[model samples]
Target: MNRDPSGGACAAEQLVEAGVRPTRPRLAIMEAIRTGATRHLTPEAFHRELADGGVHLSLATVYNTLNHFSEVGLLRRVGFGDRSYYCTNAAEHHHFYDEATGRLEDIPGAQPQVVCLPEAPPGMEIDGVEVIVKLRRSRQYPR
Candidate 1:
């Protein structure tokens, strides 16, 4: 899928393909997420961005839209501490989170090898694994 946010047509088509209605608010929210300087954003941050872009959406609306998108596989919802971040790239992948800056970046092409795992309980199965590597500047080599 095209990652460029400028491609509104692509986003609209994606929304439809994900079985979601391509409404104005949904389209705008998707575009904002795709076009954001940072690909990962919290609902509060998204609300601020949409408001700044003149796409006045309620905070509740933004949260609900993001959750819906995540549910439809249009986005990925990642949890960090007490907050949740919506990632535009829904593909299964790892991430590096900078604790100091609260920034989350994709760990490109690096899928950690999981050698073994305990068997799941009866009637349950392991769905997927998510790895989040936390990073912090060392005092000796602070940036």
Candidate 2:
């Protein structure tokens, strides 16, 4: 982990390593996401977090920054229906989404092997595969 002058961990160095210029808002956003308890966060949730910390960034800025981070390989964007969540783990992996809580949790270890994929068009090729297993409480066993 990288540390700031005050000896506290910060995301500035990681941002630079990811080829992103670390600005104040960017740093704050990165730090919040990196150190936050939740592994995945939506743009609106991120905005609220920053506001709670007294950072006061606009929702547009939060959305743009998260997208920029995804483009630069610093984060990964996972879509579920009409909502999108930003994940700090950018590596290829699968996830388990809880329908009851709307939480996304990383599936440990390597990605599962996929079989018998259809060939891509003449000019295109499949790049990667992402699997999301949705979970909900069983009706037979209420929580």
Candidate 3:
């Protein structure tokens, strides 16, 4: 795995800093994600990565760990339909979801503009906004 950009904090150190126990599986999982090709990953993909890394962990364990990490603010969970993807980037940002390839990418630079919004109900407040701009290949191209 490549060294963490911020002075090289290992998986164990990252877990501990996030107030999570530095267990073997947790460390391995963190390493798998931090070293992955992409930031957005579903449980199934993560499971395959773990398997390929020679780390034997059940699918249930992978799910549970992901859930735990999300709950502890170590990861962000993005849901679409019946599937959930875990994102390693916890910073506030939007996503571009490709319908054709079922891929999700971070929308960098600036936050999207919220032009208008209706009033909230009694005693309610706006928590936050999650914008997912879905995309698909154009069909008008000459074949």
Worst 10 residues of 3 by lDDT: 1-10
Ranking by lDDT: 1, 2, 3
Top candidate (TM-score): 1
Off by over 4 Å in 2: 1-10
Better of 1 and 2 by TM-score: 1
What are the models' TM-scores? 0.86, 0.83, 0.84
lDDT of 2 by residue, 40-141 (tens): 878998899899998999999999999999888877899869989987777778899998899898888776778999999999999777789899999999
User: Which model, 1 or 3, shows the larger lDDT?
Assistant: 1
Clashing pairs in 1: none
Regions of candidate 3 where Cα sits further than 4 Å from its true position: 1-7, 115-126
The true-versus-predicted C-alpha distance at residue 134 of model 2, in Å, is: 1.4
Q: Where is the poorest 10-residue window by lDDT in model 1?
A: 1-10
Which residues of candidate 1, in runs, are more than 4 Å off?
Answer: 5-9
lDDT at residue 23 of model 3 (Cα atoms)? 86
Worst 10 residues of 2 by lDDT: 1-10
